[model samples]
Target: MFWLPLLIVAWVATGLSCTRLCLTAYRAARPGATPGQGHELTLYEAAFLSGGPTRVTDLTLVSMARARRLLLAHTGWATVVDPVGGDDMERSVLGAIGPGGQSPIAPVRRAAAGTDAMRALADRLVTAGLALPEGTWSGVAGAVRQVRAAAAAVIALGAVALLMPAQESRGEAHVALWFTLALALNAGCLAVARFEIHPYPRWASPAGQLLLSALPARGGSDLTAVAVRGTRALSDPELRAAFAHQDTAHRSH
Candidate 1:
């Protein structure tokens, strides 16, 4: 009777906590997944793509770095760029990387001041490559759907706990105790829900970036070169036409 309800509450709490933590980790493992953008890094866990030497040669990473630098160069240092584009871009980019719109100064005290600043800066740079939403209604709708579903489930589970009477209610103040328990359970669920909707601020460490850098396996892995080459590749109409022609020719054959 009471034991079952108590057990259910405990079980639900445990499961919810685990779920929240998993969501947090999902956002954390990616060096650049931001909250506002709703896109997080998915692959590259453990060893970050196996079957490769100590060399770094992932075409995706190369393209990411290059694209980021190009955006940054056009935007200028974090402070001097255009008010609208720079601010919006940085906020969106950093938010996607789990920084949650936090200023560079927040993560500083966690480590040596110098190291923390460097790490924050590196994290910011890496974040430039993250693709998050541009704050559109569709983006909001998606986020709302997820948050609402999670929150509704939590609330419904908490309601079930209240509906079930505890055996211990046979004693004095039983009703009060039951209500208190219900409140606590409900609060716990809500808190977890809030955390899921709005995660704590954290960012990737420079070491993480360096580790990713080591994972690549090709030359021109540097962001600058990647940006230059990738941009040229995209913008050159002649090159695109040539490739399109070649592709057509190959298909015909």
Candidate 2:
């Protein structure tokens, strides 16, 4: 019975240590943010370029053609003067690209940006189920930095809590304290990587503009105009729906 408190302390300490270690390792493996991040054109970019917003039915063949041109331009490839006839762009001379797809071009390889403020640009593309085919890590360094910062903050807070004189008198408190710290650290790391850091600026602006422009135009006139002049292009049904929804919702509000 005398060992009960000691056992609890040990269990908590072990759990905390293991959890913190695992969390740290997992976060470390994650692709974080870096500096000088850029991206190729995508289907969503096509939609935005062709028109401001569009509905499901608006994505006709002409719209797609315009998107193709924009995509080629944005990617620094020879602009497609005319629309590609068939659906499959992957097998074309430009090389295959789709949602979460990669490019054969080395420079376009996915990499992280420098700041936490810009990480969301890539995050949006990633969440949209799109990426460069090669899966190169960009923006990861920045993301790592942000994650480290948050994790350190959490750890520091835990340290401070443990150092409090009032808390020291309690038995098994050290284990509980560490466990709390570990959890906080893990949460902070995740929060920083997923939310804080991103590839584009947080606000809608030039950086955001260029990144968004990379998406293939699948929507309407506003996006089509851009697509007609971009370097690369792609098309996706779901992304069109999302843009349409966002536009409609914005209009309603």
Residues 74-139, model 1: lDDT tens digits: 211111122222232233333332323222211211122233323343344345533221222233
Residue 164, model 1: lDDT of 66
- On the 0 to 100 scale, the lDDT of residue 201 in model 1 is 22
Candidate 1: how many backbone clashes? 13
Q: Which candidate's lDDT is highest?
A: 2
Name the TM-score of candidate 1. 0.25
List ranges where model 1 is wrong by over 4 Å. Answer: 1-154, 165-206, 210-253
In model 1, the Cα lDDT at residue 91 comes to 31
RMSD to the hidden true structure, all candidates: 18.7, 14.2
Q: Looking at candidate 1, what is the lDDT of residue 99?
A: 28
Q: Write the per-residue lDDT of candidate 2 for residues 175-240, one digit (tens) a residue.
A: 456546555555655555455334423222233344455443434444443344322223544434
Error of 2 at 205 (Å): 15
